[model samples]
Target: MRIRAAEEPQPGVKWIDEGGARMKFLEVDDNTIDVNCDTWASCEDELHARHLFIRWAQFACCWSQGMMASKMIN
Candidate 1:
């Protein structure tokens, strides 16, 4: 899969498959990222590929919050 800036005059990331089909649209919101997949297979594949990174990001967010709380208590 290849990720690139959207070519459709939209504000989002586009994921294209090796065969040149668009697999997903990733949009950034204020608080969340939204993914619109072309198919269930694509959705599953993308999520599977990104699962670890997603978890790591969540962990980072939580860790930062914990640090902030600890600092406030000190």
Candidate 2:
């Protein structure tokens, strides 16, 4: 799967391939985008795959919490 890097990606933005498979990021940051690449590759429970997923989840959750805090502060 090829992912185009972005500076600030909108929510629900996805990439649909010819096979009709879509992958969207939950959130994006300055450096990377947090996307659900579960089915992007046929990884049958590999350690690296799991680590990537965990990192994405962590990034998403951290962004969400930061946004919430900013909203509360403002």
Candidate 3:
């Protein structure tokens, strides 16, 4: 899959697109990130967003292990 690089960091993203999908994230009290990536395009409003502790690993996306992004970032 091809990924468009961002000029700056962005939030919650996980994707592979043999078909299309979307994921969204929400933060809680500056402490956590809640994310959902539904393969089936379920109701956006009813995704029932929640929160959890955040991590750098969790936010990393658009590339798989050993790809250039991983190499450059590491």
Please report the candidate that would top lDDT against the real structure.
Answer: 2
Q: Sorted on TM-score, highest at the top, how do the candidates line up?
A: 2, 1, 3
How many pairs of residues collide in each model?
A: 0, 0, 0
lDDT of each: 0.50, 0.56, 0.42
What would you estimate as the lDDT of candidate 1?
0.50
lDDT of 1 by residue, 1-74 (tens): 23354345654543433332233445577644444423222333666547644654676578568857986897
Deviating ranges (above 4 Å) for candidate 3: 2-18, 41-74
Mind giving the per-residue lDDT tens digits that candidate 2 earns over 17-65? 3222355676567655565533344433476557656756786688679
Better of 1 and 2 by lDDT: 2
Q: How do the candidates rank by lDDT, highest first?
A: 2, 1, 3
The 10 consecutive residues of candidate 3 with the worst lDDT sum are 47-56
Candidate number of the best TM-score: 2
Per-residue lDDT of model 3, residues 1-74, tens digit only: 33647434545553322434466777766655566664432222333222111222343443234445655785
